[model samples]
Target: MEKVIKSSDRVKDHGEVFTPKRIVNLMLDQPEIQSKINDLQATFFEPSAGEGAFLVELLKRKLKVAKNKSVSAKLFNTKSLLALSTLYGIELLEDNVEMLVMNMITTFNIEYSNIIQEKFGGKVNQHVFDSAKVIIQANMVQGNTLEKITSDGSPIIFSEWKPVSGNKVQRTEYTFESIINQSGPTGTVQGATEEMDLFADTDFFADLQKKEPRMKKYALCGWTSIYKQEIV
Candidate 1:
C-alpha cells in the first residue's frame, strides 16, 4: 500500500499514479505467474517501481523457499541473492529510485538477518552481504525505460549476477536493446565478431557491440567501475 499521489499539477507533469496493492496482487496472481514467480531463478522487471511495493511482495514470496527447515546459510544467501539480482527496475524520479532501492534492500537485509538468527544463530557472511548489495545496486537502475538510457544518457546496462565457481559471483552486463533483441549473445559473450557459447541469464539477449581495444572480451568489472568507454 504505497500511495504517494502528487498534486494534480505533479500528476499531470509526470503521469505518476501508484498502483494499489490489491490490483497488483490480482494481476500477479495468475496461475502461470504464480508458478513462475515462485521459482527461485525467475526474473522480474518493473519499469515503474514506485517505492517497490511490487518488489516487496515478490521478495516475500521468494523468501518462503529460503525459509525451509534444513536450509543452510549458503542456501539462504544464494536463493535470496538470486531473487534480488533477478529483479530489474527503471525509475524516472531520483527520489523514487532511492526509495525503491532502500525499501527493497532494507527488506532483504532485515528478513535475511532474522531468518539466519532464528535458524542458525549466526551473522551474515560479509561476502554474501556485499554481493547482495552489489546486485541490488546494479539491478535497480535510475533511467527512463522508454528512452532505454540512464539520466546521464548511457545505455541502461543491466548486469546479471550469478553464483560462479566456489562461492564467488560473475556479473555480465547487457544493454536494454541487447536484452530484448532475441537473437544476440544472451549471456556473457566474448567480444569479437565471432561465435560464443550461449546460456540463459533471465530472458536477456546480448551482443559484442564493439567500441575500444583496451577492454578484455569477457572481463567482470568491480562494483563501482565505470562501463568501458567503448560501449558508449
Candidate 2:
C-alpha cells in the first residue's frame, strides 16, 4: 500500500511540490521545535500545507509523547485530540484542501484506533471516529495566503506558526500572486519597480507582524555570487 501510494503518477508528479518527509522529520526533531511542543502555548502553522504531510507527522509525534509520559487517557483521549486543534494549515487549492482534510482524518483515525486498541482492548467506538472527522474537517481551510481571502470573501486566518530558529517563529503567509508573478512568464527581470511595489504595501507589512516582525522588505532579481573557490 505504501509503495503504491508513493509510486502513483500523481504522487510522483506532485511529490516534489510537497516537503520531503525526511526534512519534515528533521525539522520537527529540532530542539527548538521539541521545546515548543512542550510549551502548550505554542501554535503550529503551515501556510502551504500541501496534503497535510507535516501536520500528520506532528500529531503522531505528539501522540507518542503523550503515551510515553502516561499523561492520562483523558490527556491523550479523543476529546483531547479534538482540542489538540493547535495545529493549523492553509491550502490555496480547494481540491488540495479537500485532500488534506481527508489525509488528516485518516491519520487521526489510525492514531486513535491504535490508542483505543492498546488501551481498551479494541472496544470500538464509532463516536470517536465521527468526532475526530468533524474536528479535522473544521481545522483545514481553503484560501489563498497572499490574498488572505477565501474562495468567498471571508477573511482567512490561521493559528499555526511556522517554526524559524530558537525563540522565534513566523506565520506562513506567501503572497501567492506575488510569488506567481515573480516567477511567472515575465522572464525574470532582475530588479523591477513593480516587483518592489508589491512588497511595499501596508497590508503585507501588517500580515508580517506576527510572523516576521523584523523581516526587511527586499527586491529580488537574478544575481550571481562567486565564493572563494566554489561558485554559489
Candidate 3:
C-alpha cells in the first residue's frame, strides 16, 4: 500500500496526503479522463502535484499508447517526447517538486529503454533523454498554485511546446498569471510589451519586480534538440 501521509507533522503543517493508487485509477478511469488520455497531443495540468502520483500514472498510460503507434525507434522517441510535453504540474514544496521531476524522468527513461530494446534492440538515445530531462524540469515546477508564484515570489512560467511541421516543435513562454487570466495571446511567441518594460530606466528600483525577458521566441527545432532552444 502507498503511504498516504508522510508524517504527522507534514499532515498538520501542509496537509500532505497522497491519494492511493486505487483511488487514482478510479478517478482516471472516468470517461472524460479516458478520452483525454487517448489523445496524444491533449494537455493535462495538475494544480497540486505532490510527487506526481497522478502524473506518473497518466504518463504510463500515454506511453503505452505511444508505443502502440510507433513503428520506428526514431518515431518512438518523438512520440514519447510529445507525450511528455503534454503533462504539466505544480507542487508547493521544493522537495516534492524535486521528487516529481525525478519520478517523471525515471518513468520516461524506463519506458523509452524498454521500447527501444524490445522493438529495435538498441540503446537509449542520449539526445532524446536530454530533451526529456529538459521537458520534465520545465513542466514540473516548485510553486504555490494558489498564489501562482514560486517560493521566491516570482510569477511561475510554463513553456508551451507545440509540435509544428514534421518533427519540429515551437516553444512559447507564458507566466502562470497570464495563462490563468487568459489575458493575452497564449499560443503566439511573446514579444516586447511596455508593461514588461516598465521601470527599465530606473536602476534603483530594478530589483523590485524582477521582469522576464520582454521578447521570448525560440527557434523551431527538432524534438530531440529542443533543449538547446536557440533563439530565433
Q: What's each prediction's TM-score? A: 0.74, 0.56, 0.88
lDDT of each: 0.67, 0.54, 0.85
> Which residue pairs does candidate 3 place in steric collision?
none
Question: In model 3, where is the ten-residue run with the lowest total lDDT?
Answer: 187-196
Which lDDT tens digits does candidate 2 get at residues 1-232? 1222434675666442666788789988899999876654455777778778788887776656555544445434533352345567778767778888988878777876787678645554565566456446545778766665566534443322233343222323233333335543222222322333455545765443323212122222111100011211
Q: Tell me the TM-score of model 3.
A: 0.88
Winner on TM-score (2 vs 3): 3
lDDT of 1 by residue, 13-82 (tens): 8788777889879877888878868776688999888778788778777776557622677667666666
Ranking by TM-score: 3, 1, 2
Residue 229's lDDT in candidate 1: 14
Kindly list the per-residue Cα lDDT of model 3 for residues 18-65, writing each as its tens digit.
999999999999999999998999999999999999999999999987
Residue 108, candidate 1: Cα error in Å is 0.8
